[model samples]
Target chain A: MIKRKRRIETFSFFDHTGICKHLEKMAVKGWMIERLTNFGWIYRRIEPKNIKFEISYYPKASEFDPEPSDDQKTFHEFCAHTGWKLACTCAQLQIFYNELENPIPIETEPTLEVQTIHASAKKSFIPAYILLLILSVLQCFFLVSGLLGDPIDTLSNTAKLFSTVCFFILLIICTVELCCYFSWYGKAKRRQSKVSFINRQAHLFYRKLSLLL
Target chain B: MPRAKFQTLTEQMFYILLCLKDECYGLDILDKVPSMTAGRVNVGSGTLYNLLEQFLDAQIIRETKVEGRRRTYILTEKGKDMLKKEYERINAQVTDYKNIFEKEEIV
Candidate 1:
């Protein structure tokens, strides 16, 4: 019997709540998340049981770190005191699980939680997504200019047409992601209840789009 | 406008500072707050960890001892003063309530 499985789950970087719910669902089916890797999320087969999951972001953490830093270790120790065991970490994202039924949560202050998430996003995804948005916009502009400058040459080149389409798709994705993040950030700042801003339609659309790409 | 830094302590922050009154291992506060509040209030481990870091940065709490991963902390003078101020603020609210409602009862 296969004891391990790996699958790519494209959750937004800031969707820790969504990720926790998904992981909890996976645990009920007998697969426990072992670690997150460049390949995908690896799950180890376990006895089918219910477990609670929580995720937190540490902005100072980096993927390049050889091992957990002293501060991260201390944070984990504190969580462990409340029965939260560290499950895995992917860069700044930390996943923890608690077998106890009524364990106190790891994050109680919503404002602080949002700030930490925003800081982590800035450190990683925010900049990368912004750069991708810029590159896609430039590519689309050049493609359009070429089309206008020489319609025949631009239309006849299959590679050019394909690249143009890809750049357009990239542009759309980048724009949607940035807009969604900023909107969520704005709402979260006003009220922490808005922290769990899961755009299911957009998420589904992205999943289908990724499969196509 | 953004909230002023630590101007008013939230419930969790108040309890955290209350726990720090006695030098105790950082993790011990996890159990202390809930017990102190009769399980009415609970501090999440992540919340405690982050608050401790912020308090240290603000010089509200000072690390007293470290034994490998286990470290102890105590409220600094600044922290104590802040806690006292919060206590007085809450007391004033209660006093105001009594002044209005209790006087009506006597009348």
Candidate 2:
């Protein structure tokens, strides 16, 4: 009988302790774990058979100054050793690995600006709609108060009645606008969360699948 | 303290306890295991976190310290006992399997 040994691949990344927390969370579901030391800094890996892999984490980069500290140089060397492609002078590090079962080349496009605009529009709409609703209520109050009073003269009284009726009509229009805003706001938020969750799950699945292949 | 022993634990929970046998943070354990096993297992952040909460609840592991907002974990006495018993059980199973195979060859 021929016994087949499973082929395992290894990938490493240098990142902060937080990334470790993310992996440890996954390890509880039966993924194997190991820590490796190259130099003084530690590297980590998560091995799951028959899974695609992805590793994403931030790494510490040193400050740029006239005179650099030894600590800064050391940090750069550590980041280089840990397979960090990009370095930022940030405290937290994130590293992630996904098994490449279905290897799809990532396409880079300018999306941040578009996303920012959409986010701002959504945020602006929420408050504007709320304000409109409030104004509508206030207008109704003025109209009600005016109707309860007798103006000093017939002309003034007639004018007050006309103004009160106009306010009521405007209030109805604003109320409708507020309702539309709320529906739009709720749908946008729900869709955003759903899309985010699905994207995460897909990334995870691909990462795991990469390991298997 | 004697490590708390469990009659059974899910494979992930056992591996987590085993991973914490030494000083480790979340990412360290994540990277260590996959390479050690040659990528035979990978744990994702969501699953790893939920299990950590369970182990903390079970008193198997405790957060030792925070380094710049990251929590490091060390096994508690009860956790050690649980790991020890698990190791013993696995060793026994391996031995039993080896003996069975050897006897079958002789026959």
Candidate 3:
């Protein structure tokens, strides 16, 4: 009689795009996905390999937590109960695992360029807000100065004209700001969300690998 | 007057803390929880992010910006201590439940 053992395989990837692609590839290769952890930055893929089964766990350097603090310990305990592991660091591309521990070295490549992109994305909103504020103040000033016309008859008409122009300008600025804010916020948030999903997946895979080891 | 101690956290808070333990971001928590629980628990981005902000206020987790538009989370010492206590308490409960079942079987 032959004994068959259940094989649980887990793998992690730093590149979110790559992780997604790898999952697709695994699906084609007849690997059944058992679990996934989506951390928004990386993903952990747990699959059933051949009868022998293999668990592949990778970590991104960006999400690596070197020291577990009290809160982190609680978090880990929660995750452990749920059978999940911490995701990889963002700076890491590959992962090395051993019994009881997985160590990922920090990536040396400069990430300032990426940071600059995020910084600029946030800073861009300031100018838009400032422009709107200026327009609003100017409109208020024009109305208060009573420069549009005479006290009674012309004042109302002139004020109407000035107010109309101000209103239109304000409307345009507000519309643009609203649209830009949503677009910027959406794109930035979506990217962040995707990365986080991947990160959580990576963590899940790491935990599975730990069990296998 | 002394404040009353709560035995369990709100579901949102519990999930948020669970998300942060693994260095997750606000958005990541938003995406992960629903799928993790097989759609039984769905946490929207707004609610999850707010919960993370609260955790930050409570000093349970801290945020770190590592990549573009990515803010990662790490648990604080206080958070870990709380988590350890919670784990012990829960483990004790599970043990008690198991013992009860075992006693019934023996009887």
- The candidates' DockQ values read 0.71, 0.03, 0.03
Q: What residue runs in model 3 are displaced by over 4 Å at the alpha carbon?
A: A1-213, B1-7, B66-70
User: How many clashes does each candidate structure show, in the order listed?
Assistant: 0, 62, 47
DockQ: which candidate is best? Answer: 1
Off by over 4 Å in 1: none
Sort all candidates by DockQ, best to worst: 1, 3, 2
Q: What are the per-residue Cα lDDT tens digits for candidate 2 across A12-129? A: 1221222344444544443533322232233233343443222222112222234434533433333333333221222222233334454321101112112322343344433555
In terms of lDDT, the best-performing candidate is 1
Q: Give lDDT tens digits, candidate 3, residues A1-213.
A: 212223433432223343545544553454433333342223234343322111121111123446544443333333333323333222222121111222111111112212322333344434556677677767656555655444465366865667756655665455544454345444545453322223445455544544443
| Residue lDDT tens for model 1, B6-98 | 999989999999999999888999999989999999998888998999999999999999998889999999999999999999999999999
Cα lDDT of model 2 by residue, B1-107, tens digit:
21232456545567767788888885566566556667665544433544565578878899987775356788999889988888888889999999999999999
Chain B TM-score for all candidates, comma-separated: 0.94, 0.83, 0.73
Per-residue lDDT tens digits of candidate 1, residues A139-194? Answer: 88888899889989988999988988888888888887778788888988887543
Worst 10-residue stretch by lDDT in candidate 2 chain A? Answer: A104-113
Positional deviation of residue A99's Cα in model 3 after best superposition, in angstroms: 48
